[model samples]
Target chain A: MTTVPVRPPLVRSSDRIIAGVCAGLAEHLGWPVRMVRIGMAVAALAGGAGLVFYGWLWIMVPTADESAKRNARRPASPIAPAVSIAPAVSMPPNQSAAVGPSLWSDAYSPGYPSGPVAPPLGGPAAAGPVGYSSAANPAPSGPYVAGAPSQAEGTAAVPGTGAWFRVRNMRYGKEILLGAGLLLVAAILIARLLGVEVPLGTLIPAAAILGGAAIAWMQLDETRRAGLVDKTKADQAGGWARLAAGLALVVAGVLVMVSGSGSWEQTWLALLASVAVLGGVALVLLPWGLKFWRDLETERAGRVRETERAEIAAHLHDSVLQTLALIQRRAANEHDVVRLARAQERELRGWLFRDPARDAGQLSDRIKAAAAEVEDGLGNAVDVVSVGDTAMTDRHEALVQASREAMLNASRHGGGPVSVYLEVSDGGAEVFVKDRGSGFELHTVPADRLGVRESIIGRMKRHGGSAEINSSPDGTEVRLKLPAAAEDNGEGKS
Target chain B: MSTPALDGTAGDPGRTVRVVIVDDHAIFRSGLKADLDPRIEVVGEAGTVEQAIEVIGRTRPEVVLLDVHLPGGLGGGGREVIAGSAALRGTTKFLALSVSDAAEDVVAVIRAGARGYVTKTISGAEITDAVYRVAGGDAVFSPRLAGFVLDAFGTAPADIADDELDKLSARELEVMRLIARGYSYKEVAKELFISIKTVETHVSAVLRKLQLSSRHELTKWAAERRLL
Candidate 1:
């Protein structure tokens, strides 16, 4: 039996300190906030590798509201934001902050601080978030304010813009080498504080290993649509494997930091070896990285294409469209000339205004394509409109054919432009072919008119559909109705 | 602004109707203006949303032939031009003219305050008559516009122009259905056995309902924003 996952999504908590790195990590790993904090502090004191990891997580881990937005089905109750804190333990950091008295004080806080902190790396981190979260949120067991930052504070961050989803991937990245200068400063400051001669050679390898682990750590959570219920598996072995690989990197990094020597050549080799290890990790994540890159490239290409299209439109407006206006003005008294120019103008406008990638299979496209054929052959202008669309049914061909015939009948008899209105929904698809022609009596039409009877009515009836004709002196409208596919009804039940 | 060809006084049945043509293509605008009825005057012309607003403000034309897609004002196009002319809305009506039947674009403009929508393929005389009717403060529904009103209000989901925005009255539905069936306004009046003026009032009322309640409008506005 499948059970709902109670585990919180790995998002940086709304309540946080510094950048909420430790709090988010503690939250995801099910450890006391203080323990993760101490681990980070010790790592920081050792070689400043922790700050690089912290900085990376700060940039990568989405804040609480973003997490809530991504996995709407995580819970409606806002419980997912309650990252790390037990009623009996580690909330002393929050207690010390003196903000809102408890988690319940915040409007979106779904969990009352209770139960054990849970298993895994339990203790030492949850310290600083209590301070900043007090500004954005309110600390548990502190005086609550009526109007704190709350949800807005967490969601206010502007995500990166421009070529956000690129399609081109660099299998071997340039190695941005972020935080090297900061790593040096942090190392020197800590080395002096601890009164130990810091071995500068080992710093590079430790930083590389830590950076590599953080790179893999960023992929822990899945990104989904803004507002949809996601009910995927509670946990995947892949996630565990990544997490295990990350911890091994941390252990190996610390060991190298402890044992690394001061020789320049050996330090260079260690750096290369650590990079090789990272390359192996990157190889494991090649597919995911490739897809991510492709999205960014695709978005960038779409933007460039849009600019090019606008340029083409501007050029066309100056040339061909200007010429058409002359034709239109000169042909003002000529009905056919005016119609032809207007038709050409419409074609140009459609090309310029059509969406870059309109789905050809949509009912509107089908309706317009059929209408165009009639316009070209019969010299009758047709207005096609489709309001909403649905999945194509087995009866779709019958529906389109009947509509085409109706258009033909209207354009031929009416000697005027016809209007085709299509509405496709779960219930079914309905097409209305309206013509500005004089009335017709269905019975009086004489059975010799096989165009209406055999082509439209008969076709529809054979395909489990129906057709009705509404005729009056002003005009006539042929209505066609096709039921949605039989396969969809059962699928819709759940 | 173009001067009226024939100097006719206002309030006369045969008087000239001042109009604004707000289309992106200057060629199409001139073509349409050239083909219009002699009784209808092209008082103003604009090829973009900003220009439309400025020209409409300066000329105060009786009816504006608005294009649904144009080059300015947040890509709202005709909708934005109409929104920018909120002050002139009572005196100046909008009749949306589009080359395509993109439902969202048509519905968005209608919700923003277009009195009616007609495809660009409409004849010059029909557009001329439409202007005169709109000038007389009538909602001119081309057959396709009526069909759009029916489908959008009749049976789409909440996200796509369903009942939450506004539900049409039975009388309005009958009127729209008849129009969709290609009945002229006079014919619809006769079929419903009501006065022509009353029919106009009902059509205008349906438009008001589409963008009436702030509550109903918010959902639709949010949906439109999301789509864009």
Candidate 2:
């Protein structure tokens, strides 16, 4: 039987309080809105005066009202600014803050909120609502807004440029940690107001535990999003085990917190011991999680390799096989056919097998920008433009990279002015990199040219895609086509 | 006008062979058709497997020359072409024609019951030759396919060895030959008036000493060796 990925709700531990469980349980049980609050109160009462655990729950889980408001406001609010500015700035819907709601939703889940009220630890100023292509809201400083016309503002984001640092920035993990710390503080303050004993030592250890866990949670969250589909039953089981262990550690920490030393001063030592125990559990669980993650990654890598192999096989079937098959059918001169067949066979037999990597930038901005970067790098006069609104995907990125690589090669090896055009059609997207450079005949080049294989054709073929290089003394035109992912039949053919 | 009268009902005359052509490009079918003599009628042409199936059901050509890559089809769609057709068993023939001459493709297509496997680069003459061959009884594999065909059909036997059975002395070999020619071990025992176990031991020894893997292999070896 196929197992669905179980996304469990967060549970409070003395170590950390992530409101995720209340939300998850709320979601799972289809409970009425206030059920989590009632459940928390009952749990606190049952667990004996609920001093530590109640505080943990209060801090860990977000208020149900907030979650409901966030959910309701999601589709309506965050997208307005991005959508309004999209046409004006010429930014695609994909690259813009159209994803704001989802990103914010994930970030601001009760367990980890990066709102103004719950700043990440060290309290970096929260990113204000951003405008596209504005001076202050340049690609670096501003949230990516889909369909926002970005002209010179986008130029700064080219790699190696001063503005490029913003594009390369990856601080979401840190932001999540800070959010967790803020939640813990808020929880402790609330507990004090509720007339609970506030011990510095207990707070310190609890804070430490929370801080480390929040950091790990953020990184793990990123990793999970990156490619952590449970490809196998064993890995799925590992995920379940990790969740169990995390839950267990949290429970143990709570037990220590509620046990409350004979006096308020001793509470600090208890908190420290509790933290050490929880931290030790997490540390022990770390290797297992990593092991499962690595296994999943390896399985993914293997799948990708298999896909590449299948692609090459298909390409060979298409190019070399078809070419030879054509020659076989039409060759009037048997000797010529034999010679051509042999030559083709040798070429195919030579590179028959191949072994086979990210990321968001709008299709247009990325293509033109990539073209400009290559042109700048190679000192070649090049013109790059997008023909239409292209939905961004790794395949499109690959096509652009291929075109850029081709342009670079033409400029360096072939040597001259290059023209790049990015067009999106119903079939797929194509990046045509043409150059009036010192063009080499296809036969003159070595059979296995790195640029031709890796930068041009290899990238396209990885996605069940295709490419063609036509060159004479006049110029070279590299037509790179990335097949639509929806068109991906999920397996390699040849 | 003497057209060679298509007289013989080769096999299952009532059944129509369902075929699906799975090339991403369309131009190939016409060219392949022209090069391939008019003997085999074209049924349906699909740029991908989905279309191939729709066409297969519609036209139901006896043989499908499936391409490895058709844009929106499953990977290894050559397999899909064969396996998808419910009527493939003992009825339809699949001929995989693609640009790849990889050993894997050859193995895959064959495993998928492509009676014939050839690359897209195969000459029109050879393709016609392949079509006719597949239309007949024999499987038409490309010259490059020789290795794969050998590998697919000639795996090492897993069970008992003939040589081990051959451990019996020369007398046992004679007894085994007699048993193989329809003399049961009991009959041999009765005829030779030896105990059944002794006969059994001799037969077992003979089978072991022959270095054969199975009784079938021993028979085959004996037949090939002309001992039978």
| Share of the reference A-B contacts seen in candidate 2 | 0.00
B1-228, model 1: which lDDT tens digit per residue? 001111121123588888899998989988998899888888889998899999999999988999999998898788899999999969999988886665577677887988777777666656776777777776777666666676657543234354543677778878776666556677678779997777778888777766564555434533542121
> In model 1, which runs have C-alpha deviations exceeding 4 angstroms?
A1-365, A423-429, A438-449, A463-465, A470-474, A481-494, B1-12, B23-25, B46-58, B67-77, B156-165, B215-228
TM-score between model 2 and native: 0.30
Highest DockQ against the true fold, candidate: 1
Top candidate, metric lDDT: 1
For model 2 chain B, give the 10-residue run with minimal summed lDDT. Answer: B1-10
Fnat of each prediction?
A: 0.17, 0.00
Estimate the TM-score of every prediction. Answer: 0.51, 0.30
- Residues A1-494, candidate 1: write the lDDT tens digits: 35954666567876577877788888888899999999998988778888877887888778988777645543331221212111122223443134423222232122222322311111111111221221211223123221122212222211111112210122112233345646676878798799988755676657657765775654333322111223345334555666777666775666567556545576567767876998999999999999998996686465445434433433343224333433444565465453445445445545545565545465666777787767655656776656566545557877988999999999898766677777666677789888767968889988897999999999999998899998877678899998776776423210
